[model samples]
Target chain A: MNMSRIVRSTANILFPFILVFGFYIIVHGHLTPGGGFQGGAVAATGFVLLLVAFSPDIIRDKFSFNSMKYTEALGLLLFIITAFVAIALGTTFFFNWLANGGIIFGESVAFGANPGILNSAGTIPLMNVAVGIEVIGAMGLIIMYMLSGIEGGNKE
Target chain B: MKSKEILTAIIIAVLAASLLLPSALMVFGSPQNDGMDSYMIDNGQDIAAVNNIVTGVVFDFRGFDTLGEALVLFTAVLGVTLMFRRMKEDEEYEYE
Candidate 1:
């Protein structure tokens, strides 16, 4: 077994586990010390590892910068829209009016968790998840591009 | 960057202060808001509605600015990449 194939196998086996762990950190952020930025960085590590083990062309084909561009913008827009909704409801901008215990899907889950200490912070947890997704995609794309240059590929 | 300059100045100030340690005793700064401490503990949760005080302060009270901070590095990367691409294209055209 050569180095590249071994790397590929290792990355494939580990990527899903890394993503699930990242999601766990993001959802449980309010209760624990990890939040959007930390979880997002962790999530991006999988993409980065894949980029390192594979070729740049594969990285580009798998995750396009254009899609990441939209994902980043959408994340920001979602955050803004969430804040604006609060404003439209007659509260100040970015107010957590709905965070204190709102009913979602006929069940009450604290901001991101159910009946837990992490449940009190309303939209903050949701925002963390959104930001986490955005940051992971953005960082993954950026790192992949940079790695392509180092890997002797000029096509982006 | 003004932020970078300000950070540099703060480091310099701290270093200078270490040289003249006597003034450190007189460097205590007063709080800006008269009742900020009490108000924070009393009405903090209600205003931001976040269980974590830091989260409320960062995302709720200072959200607009946080968006700008997040985009700064993204924009910088995009700018550098564009400039490099433009220069490379210009060089290739000149060669042709």
Candidate 2:
């Protein structure tokens, strides 16, 4: 069942802002206090808000269970693949190979404090994105599954 | 019943003492070993090229731990999915 019109409208308005904030946290994780897991949780909370405001059938139609499952796997796969790429480049596992490589995300940082750079931080940002995606998927799935269980219980 | 109450009180006292003793003895906001902490603070920015030293340490210097943590989350999601799937199947079976 759906919530009151006021609640539904509020959730609708706030959802996009929440998602944008979450993405900002994920992308700027290298420069900010929040990172992948925290940002993903924030984003998943937005989805939870929607689940609470709307009917389960509406959420199920919009966000497929299979897609969420695939997203979780893909995120983990991307993370591991990035690590393995380090090995392929003749470095130890999880090495910061791209830190000073002068390539993508490879601008060398000066020794001490300065304004944070978004294009720097090398594989750290990449890993952060990967983990963020994984976390968003995993957290969304857990809540969705529990909601399903609750619906099933209601039916019986 | 009195003996049981005494035993519970003793257990709670011991647990509280164990938790409080460490905080009472150690200095707040100062680590026992600053060697690694100092090194990371000094060089983590240059090495990882990130302003956030905590992110550098988590994703670069000690990335394996992060990977393990991700694995743990994936496993938990998997377990939840499996449990719920079984419950659904059981419900269907019952209907039949």
Q: On a 0 to 1 DockQ scale, where is model 1?
A: 0.19
Q: By DockQ thresholds, what CAPRI class is model 1?
A: incorrect
Estimate, for each residue in B1-93, the C-alpha lDDT of model 1 and write its tens digit. Answer: 699999999999999989888665554665446586656545656554544555555666667775675677457557645644424444654
Identify the leading candidate in terms of TM-score. 2
| Prediction 1 global C-alpha lDDT | 0.67
All DockQ scores: 0.19, 0.56
Off by over 4 Å in 1: A1-6, A105-115, A151-154, B1-38, B45-49, B80-96
lDDT of the structure predicted as candidate 2: 0.89
Model 1: share of real contacts kept: 0.21
Deviation from native of the Cα of residue A41 in model 2, angstroms? 0.5
Candidate 1 lDDT over A109-148, as tens digits, reads: 3233233455556777777777787778678757755654
**RMSD per model, one decimal:** 7.9, 4.0
> What is the lDDT, from 0 to 100, of the residue A134 in candidate 2?
96
